[model samples]
Target: MNPLLRLLVLALVLPAAACSTLSAQQRDRAIAIAAAARAPAVDCGQPDRCAEPSPLRALAGEAFAASAAAPDGAPHHYALLLDEGGDALLARVNLIRSATRRIDLQTYIFDTDDSARLVLDELLAAARRGVRVRLLIDQLSAIADLQILAALSGAHQNLELRIYNPTFNLAKPNYLHYAASVVCCFRRFNQRMHNKLLVVDEAVGIAGGRNYQDDYYDWDAQFKFRDRDVLVAGPEVRTMERNFAAYWDDRRSVPVERLNDVARRLLADGVPAMPPARPAHPRRVEALSQAASDPETVRTQLVARAMPVAAVEYLADLPDKHHGDSALEDGVGAAGLAGLLAGAQEEVLLQTPYLVLSDHALEIFRGLRGREAPPQVRVSTNSLAATDNPIVYALTYKYKRRHVRELGFDLFEYKPFPADPPVDPALGGWWPGQAPADAPDPEVARSELPGGSLGGSRGSAGEAQVAAKLRTETRPSLLRTSAPANRPLPVTGAGPRMGLHAKSMVIDRRIAVVGTHNFDPRSETYNTEAAVVIDDPAFARALAASIEGDIAPGNSWVVAPRAKPPVLSGLNYSVGKVLERSPILDLWPWRYATNYEFQPGPECPRPLPRRDPEFHRCYAPVGDFPEVSLGPKSILTRMLTAFGAGLVPIL
Candidate 1:
């Protein structure tokens, strides 16, 4: 290591000596303080458990009972795709409410916002009613608010919470502590528990990309995630239980009382008595609560949507995903998706928010493309304007050529917001069963937003006119920004924006995969993740349809090769390829491909392939980054495209 770097590391690690780990005396005192706030046990008649009698719980019971007689390895499981955000949240709510014996939820981030608080309230209620509730959150992003972690320290005797892989054994690390942690224990700090799951009563569960935050469930007014999740019952739930237990019992999964920040809060303030939470949107909460409890509504929205499958295999990475001894295949989530794709006989439909691909992932695609009869590869990912992580989007931008020219990928970058922006600001309620009712028709309601045509995805001439309107509203100049990866170019609209966060795939339209694995290097090598792989053509088709909807011209932008410059097109291609192939920098101004809008007309009723002779005639080039300004983000993207390959493994 460099001498200055070594000295800096030493300086960072030294101050952590006084970190708030509990000594013997302090430990006892902390225990005493927390004991006072311990949840009162509710003794229900049945074996210290209060299992609910509801249609949701019954679905699991019936699934397990029916699965008992299935083949040893191929057991029956029912799966439901939660493409809509409201239904996704409603699923979690009903599953928790219906949980009889135990509820285990594992997530990457558990924010203290309304969405999280409402779910937290539910888990607390479940604990109070005598249902064992255990929540395990990744330490880095888990409960950043120290007070909430402190209160949760003694929230309930039945409700247990653990922070996974805490740096300096602290629940909420300060900026100083975080810097030192990255310097002193880089591997541990980088490898997080990216798993998102909710297993109830060891009978049913939800596994997918949603973290406990408003954005994931379309509740955030500023932004939302078009995320996906799979609700599974029967044999798959057993796998979820075991996977969660592995993380729960792992050494790195530290208890609340063991954390330094949480411990200090417990010692200084005693265990905090949690006040009754008042939801940010009471009507929204009430709507979901009523729908979750209503058997008819739950049945119609969830149970009816479920399709029985021959096999629903649950795959998850080991708790120590980045351990030195772990093999690449130890990432169960990655391996499952790989195996499914390897057998894609017809087409492969993949959707993920972060589109950066690891070398291993690129190699997989390469292998598929090398086949004599390669299947169609369709990818739906966030565009520059729609993405939450501008950094990751830059990486995706860096490799657009390889994805389109080499891999033959039908790349569809999701629009900022779609016609049906998951929450449906149209109806009275937002839940899949209950929706927002205060809106006029979608056309009128959408037009009221800053960039009303933003979600139209229609690729119409009117869209260009709206873009002109948006340009007038936005600041002409880019804001002065200095951050390398955090800088964001201004998107056209300022109103509520939506991004795609769903990580999913449909293979041969025969299998459906909905999981938290983004297939990036982090998911492939660093963080642990989990997913459900269901083998049912019906389910696969249903999943494909949902993804297809997201990629519709009105919902997304087609990424394709820009028509070769009329003159010296050949020379431009050669030079561009050389710059692209350069190991260090990809500075060629002209890119191989750009976003295209499908111009609908009497002559062109449907989409056309880029190879079609009349492709450019029907599809208009929309520049490299549409609805996005020329700014620091674009400059950084070019810089990273040249120098960011090394950052891929860690990022």
Candidate 2:
């Protein structure tokens, strides 16, 4: 290792020993925190052990929430839609800061940025207070930094860490990392734990798309998102906790201590002793407008109403209907509006960041468009300018104009928010779920329509005009800033351009299923996805209203010729559209594009492997694509990278 890198690792490994020169109050608080970590596990009836449900069992609306429950059972959970900014971010962060008894965190990706660090610090503080902290991060997404992990584990005896599907490289006949992943193909990659959850003291849970990253939390000053999350309590706590335990105990998970020496030391130090916690950051009730003054709606609406239900493990031998056994449910049909596209619904509104629609998805929408109601189907997504993944943009852009014209659905594309001029008076704070009257007139904001041409998807002139307005009216300029910017926003559009992350559809405010599943083929067929479909009109109405009133205007643009495709987004946008249109075409010659390949190993029934160079290249992208480093390769790194490649399929 380079001297600088070696020194850096050592610095992380050995931090300054706890300062002996501490104030008496500080010491007392620290000691008190230690005691709380030893409290007995909050029991929620041990989570419907040995029970399971069929994978084919579709839980429509009410049935989905039926599984949510608290240990004692009054539905104290809340299910408010998080389609706005500022308040929602604060609400979730506040919840994490206040968690006292135990914090169970799991995620596919956790970036090591300011927001991530801030939350990490909060977890550490809670751990010091005797709060038992157990964290499970997806090894595929979390680049293992042993030194950092070791230091963190060593700092708190109350914290337990584990990695889901880990890998490391090696040299010789085979890399150890490769071998690990090969074994995980069936047990790990096929069944990814894609759920992002934060459960605290059995009293609250936060489940949604937000990862532990600055961009996700809207902490980045340059660009921020208007995303959503459900802060749940009640019966749902039992279900989520049960789900968590299944993944926790799964054979694919490796206690992080096995890899980090410091983690081992911390575990050896033993659990701390501490007092039990009362509810912290409890839920609050109010009107949609009231959510502004009352931030507790997140907790009260989402977490407060959960009640327990049957527990289902990943590979448990449960009833065929609710079984969580296979990597993906094959052949069996999924319930809901599969072919219902033939029947007319008044309207269909679909928003997705990754839009890789399959034949089934296309047919459903088209069928709906042909119905008697001739429902006005409106689809919204980022213009080429806003897409984070250019390839995904390419895949979906191809159908923009065609869908709008042929399917008769209005298409809306988002343009960047305009720059606010210096000394502009409207530097006002926003209320949750309500657009301020002082804010721009909502009507004046145009509804974004798709571009005009069927084959050529480009923003309409109306879109260009609206884009200009956003730059001048809604967006604030980061350039000529008063302080150092974490990330600089584009000179045009509002702040930074953030992609649409909400994965849901509100059908006349009568039904909604909001979960972690994206509207892409990867999410549908390749990855394991979970969502809760809510049928209650009251709740669904609230969800729809939030999206329309709070989310639509500023974040999106209202364009004309809803028939046209949006503007050209460059290579990423073009290619992604082609891929999206061709479901069978999985491989392309792009460097970082997503590819669908057959799962590795003989366990999967498919075409047999061959060593032909052309054949291998085509399939290589499916499994462990090779990587060559720029710097001199070290023995450990080469091994670790090999290991990483082996596990790529599962990761």
Candidate 3:
């Protein structure tokens, strides 16, 4: 054999040989770390305290809407909505540079994009600063980006990385699905660590929908998927700190040291040794000072914010109890949240990106509407026109008309953001107010009553409608004067303004819940999920108002329904009504895809092509969605199966 071939053979054989040899080493290392990181077992009796809080709560609150304030009256000041890629990256880098104590990160995907590299650079810097850095990522999601992980491993002794639920087949000619992964979907390769969180020094935290990816931060020129995240600094963050520790110490979360030489080499080459943190605003510290001041002042101003919930005594999902369970919760939180919605006496405003409600959810939504009828229940999500996930839209769209007519659940899809929103020229950036997290509200709202004005509502539509409505609206001059007539059309109506990626719902301004779960099938059935449901009336009202205000005409859009909604035939209307009533599809309609603009062109006047017709390549590659359908074959189904199977992970 050629020397290179000989080397390849050795490399192939080495993993298994090393695994056997390193078995004890890996176990000992994991055990040593686990032992040191063990959390104290404490009884949860006080409503405000728990035996332990997950480190994730730093970014996400221990209790929904819980204030970040600590007892010393030092307002727990944290930044939220770092929409700019540069700004977000700077925040993490600053935290790393500033850290004096510890660094903890947990993510579903800590990829190797510039953002991820930037984060890695910071993590290495923190480690060099003598900050203890612990990284926990899902075993499966990280496999594709193994080089980054390897890079981190090669250089940082102070840093300990763990892969949650690592696949056993890593080295062998193996074929067996880990039970956990199978239930959670392919991201898990069946299981997942779907949490997005970062806690530094147990003081500052970042959490929300944005993953550690380039697209997440608007670094890519291609269409950036709008998402949301919250930064926190408060006593509640300790809860998240604890969660990170818990997962970090879990025995099943294998130490990255266990990875084979090949994987390890890949990582080592992929990541360079730590670099010192560069200043976030090395030149412009003054601006950060101002942004930081706002959050700090706001926290202090809201003095009466509720304290943490009293601790409840319980085991933290003991493996023996509900071990390997498929559901996120046993239903207590779900039931409580539903009760909050059901108790709604008036209006209900929801902005969920993925709305796949189960029968139980539908019943809860229906009950809130007074069973088949009510004052009004409005929901804003991506139209097929706006949704990224067309299949999910297909599943959910089945219920649109029924929810509208029966429950009076009026549905509106986001229009695109306008070419211009009031820009902060000082920031040298267009705020674009609220763009779509795949859900853009119109620039203006039509009358609260449906057919109020085509003339009146031209600019009323938001970023979402701007793309499609420009061709149709009557006041071409107004739009032309205000923006190019070719600018995307604004949505019409008194309909609620939309948002990009806020999975929140407010019931008569009484309660709300926001978290990882979207209002769609992928969230409900496919992935492991978590959320915080807030019962505070004030918070709910504020949240609802904030959502509404963002999409409001001056900031967003409120458009009227089509003067003549493409009138459905009595038969189609009846079918829509029937489909809408179906529990499974009704709660999470899929029709939104019908509206997704498949073609990308200059803003235009007509509906986009139904299919790509030519399957235009995805302009922005989201690293390939992993293909899962590899096994089994019938001659006829083989090719079709292969093609379809390839898309399973992305879906």
Candidate 4:
């Protein structure tokens, strides 16, 4: 039997033995606790409440109504949100403040961070103004604070919060209980609502990869995600509203009042109501409020001045997609994405944080490559040094070479910190060709070598020699930057470490897709995903420009045909590569390894000072390597990964 399989078998059997040790009294107490945690269902009546008119409609609805009319005959209006963090936040807040009738929000993760609080405060404020608010969040990530959510919902009659596919046990949820719950309810626990969208007044919406968190918006001091989102106003907003209603009306979506009667009672017993924190960025709030005052100006500035309307299609998986239902019922699935890719005539650009290609995706790639006139295919994903999830990186690393060779796809791995100077806004920030001359070309092999030769398969003596040769090569050329010698360094210090979290695709410079779906098994089979596919050349080019900035040499590493050789300068890289090939050991503290890979070493250059404290760092360039580490918390994380690896197919 496989060692990993044997270990998993032992785990399943041993857990039962441990449970057998519990006395009858202890078992009863546990059952009582779980019973108390499970809340009774509350019926909110029909979904028609969401369509009611609001007082603000008279003030702010005219612009959206006009935009949706498309006097010029365009299908939709879109503005690419490239503000890193603040811009996206402001956009959502502004929409909420401007909304007159209803606001619908659906997200996978609604963190307790400042970003979430800011948005939540705005929602409460909107509700106070008599605008209806409906929020749908996945229960898996939101169950820990049921009392708080219940209190919030109870406080506002106009605002309703629903937890999608909630667990029966919600009180004081710990890791062990979570694991037990998963074991008992494996089917429901494995599936998540991995969708992020916000629609205002059923007239305009914002949808894309960003979640409600500081890191997504560039506010996290330690880490920042290079992400993307789109501001949409037009007929597509109505489609988004319909998607929200489907999830909101699903039987599995339990209202917070219904989730735990005990928690609801506790709230009635006078638990202190916790109001949202004061806005961290007060100026941002002021700006949004000012923009809300003039809906026409906001629309003109966001859409007319910058983005233009074009053909748009909203695509989303059904709330019941986890039930193994047919793709026809879901409306969105891997098949939709595959069909989109198949239609590419000249070029396909993809940006995803994770890239664990499925068999179906691989077959599509193979089909594309087999074509007599194959389009140029390029992919940008998180590098080992930049990925937040190391287990996913390990799996993706195993197939890196195959993706490049078999599919002829250009792959670029993002760098944690690039040393190039801040990009000129006029030239488009982080433009291509900002890295050293020696950076690998995705289309060219280092040598004319066949498969299984040097730089090919693992375990070959020739491959080892090739790795050694690569390690010995001079590093100066690879570290050179595009900045002039006389240019002064940033004064504020290095900015937050950057990672790729955006899920976007631009095909043939005429079609674009932006959403929360990562190109991995989890997204393909386990989680429900959402995105907007725009079929306009102008809109596609705008999105493509933002994606190209992320793939630029200064911001990302081009995956070479040869594996990046282990070097003393990148000790974490050596360890990560070794772990990637190991069976039991690879799971060792994957998160620690991921962190270690991106941690600065002795050779790392000092962060230049910048005048603005929020200014992002422009690092001195460096060579590529596998980023990894063994840290103090690795043991538990590694053990978790070991167990979780068994569920990778479903994950």
Q: Using TM-score as the measure, which candidate wins?
A: 1
Tens digits of per-residue lDDT, candidate 3, 391-492, equal 444334444444545555555454434322211212112122222332211222223312132112222333422232211221221102233222222333
Task: Quote the lDDT for 262 in model 3.
Answer: 24
The root-mean-square deviation over C-alpha atoms between each candidate and the true structure, in angstroms, is 5.0, 16.8, 14.2, 14.7
State the RMSD for candidate 1: 5.0
Please provide the root mean square deviation of candidate 2 (C-alpha atoms, Å).
16.8
Tell me the spans in candidate 4 whose CA falls farther than 4 Å from its real position.
Answer: 1-76, 143-147, 169-172, 261-272, 276-306, 324-334, 419-495, 563-647
Off by over 4 Å in 2: 1-76, 97-100, 169-192, 260-345, 418-495, 549-555, 558-651
What are the per-residue Cα lDDT tens digits for candidate 1 across 195-311? 999999898889899888877776664566788898888877888899899899988898888776777788898887676677767666666676677778677666777887777
Against the true structure, candidate 1 has what lDDT?
Answer: 0.74
TM-score ranking of the models: 1, 4, 3, 2
TM per candidate comes to: 0.89, 0.54, 0.58, 0.68
lDDT of 4: 0.58
lDDT of 4 by residue, 1-651 (tens): 566865665576546434423445543443344344432332234343232332233323444555568678555454455434544665676667766668999987777666677788778777766678898988766634544664564556577778887655342344554555555556677778888899987777788887776667654444556778876766677888998899999887876655443243443453336544666554434544454455553444343334555577788887767665634532354338778887788899999887877666778778889899999898988875566655565456555545665677777787655433122111111211222222222223313222121122112112111111111111111111233211111111133445678899999999989887775777877788888888878888877877776666545665543222334425544555566445455542211111011223464443222222321223322333332233343343344334444445663
User: Clashes in candidate 3: how many?
Assistant: 90
CA shift at 216, candidate 3, in angstroms? 2.1
Point out the worst 10-residue segment of candidate 1 by lDDT: 471-480
The 10 consecutive residues of candidate 4 with the worst lDDT sum are 469-478
